[model samples]
Target: MKINDVILRTVTKIVVFIILTLSVYLFFSGHYSPGGGFIGGLVLASAIVLMYLTSDIETVHKGMPFDFKLVAALGVLIATGTGFASVIFGKDFMTQAAMKLNLPIFGETELASVVLFEAGVAMTVIGVVVTIILSISEDE
Candidate 1:
């Protein structure tokens, strides 16, 4: 498959950046909004796939800073660690806690431990999906 159209490549670059930004926003706003790590990760993975489709595999690899598999493993470790961390505090595994912090612009905000777990989920999802896409792309 070849994609040599300049317009398509330019559009893809703009769209990929937008999607990536939106994915991060979704991941961060997940706790209070409808979006979450799962959706965010999916969106991010899709953006990466779009990049792969618009350009060569070498470009995609260069764009990505690290290995997806390592990311997946680290995500798993983080999620598992977060769960066990609760146990260390005498709380049940996966128990969630929140704290209120006063900020300058945002005023008062509540930060939850679950956010870390969601981050792990997001990273794992991104890693798994990217790995699958790259593997398939390479086999062809």
Candidate 2:
């Protein structure tokens, strides 16, 4: 590729990656604060759409290989399972899971089901987005 094309491609990749990372962070943070899974997932999915557009089929096939689809599925399962947990316990949907945390560097933390639900949402959002992008990009 020409130097100009190479520069453009690199910049594009960097920008997309930054946007994707920020979205994931925002989605995760939103669980405690203002953000939540739906918006976060959509933001993540949109970034993947950009990636699908910018990349060729071969590149996407090699890089992701449908893994995102599986991840998204797992995320849904987790979220759904959380609901089930509440129902089984005769509590409301996504009642706190009563969990413990070990953050390594940050040390221990208190974890709750709502936060876990957010994690599931974050994964689902990121995964579904990547999956959609790959599928749509390939369709083109």
Candidate 3:
């Protein structure tokens, strides 16, 4: 690749790494704190958008490891499904509730399932947004 390519790639990689890493932290923190999934996912998508700016979609495809559409779809499905999950049990939509945890790292963690649902929404929002933006910008 050209020297410009190398530099841009490096910058994009750094940015993506930082944003994604931060996103994970923020996303997890949101479970117990104020931040939510929408912001975290948007931040994550920002990282991907940074990479998209520096490289072609073809290269991004190779590095991303999975289909963004699929991942995003899963997030949305999970979030929307959360609504159905409530009604299935005869609960109201977007109702807040506690859930059990079994993780050894954070044993007996108290998590609000609604928060998890919101986080999934965040992921899907960012994913769909980035997809649209990248596709549109590709023409230029």
Best candidate (score: TM-score): 1
Q: Write the per-residue lDDT of candidate 3 for residues 1-52, one digit (tens) a residue.
A: 6455787777776777778889887777876676678878888888878877
- Candidate closer to the true structure by lDDT (higher is better), 1 or 3: 1
- Scanning candidate 3 in windows of ten residues, the lowest lDDT window is 1-10
Q: Which ten residues in a row have the lowest lDDT in candidate 2?
A: 131-140
Off by over 4 Å in 1: 1-3
Model 1's alpha-carbon lDDT is: 0.89
lDDT value, residue 12 of candidate 1: 94
| Candidate 2 local lDDT, 1-140, one digit each (tens) | 63346766777788888887877787767745777777777877777677666666668668767678788889999888887788888988766766678998878876666766776877888887776656665553
Off by over 4 Å in 3: 1-3, 65-73, 99-104
Backbone clashes, candidate 2: 3
Output the lDDT of residue 17, model 2.
Answer: 84
- Cα-lDDT of candidate 3: 0.78
Per-candidate Cα lDDT values, in order, are 0.89, 0.74, 0.78
Give all TM-scores, in the order shown.
0.92, 0.69, 0.77
> TM-score of model 2 relative to the true fold?
0.69
How many Å off is the CA of 137 in candidate 1? 2.8
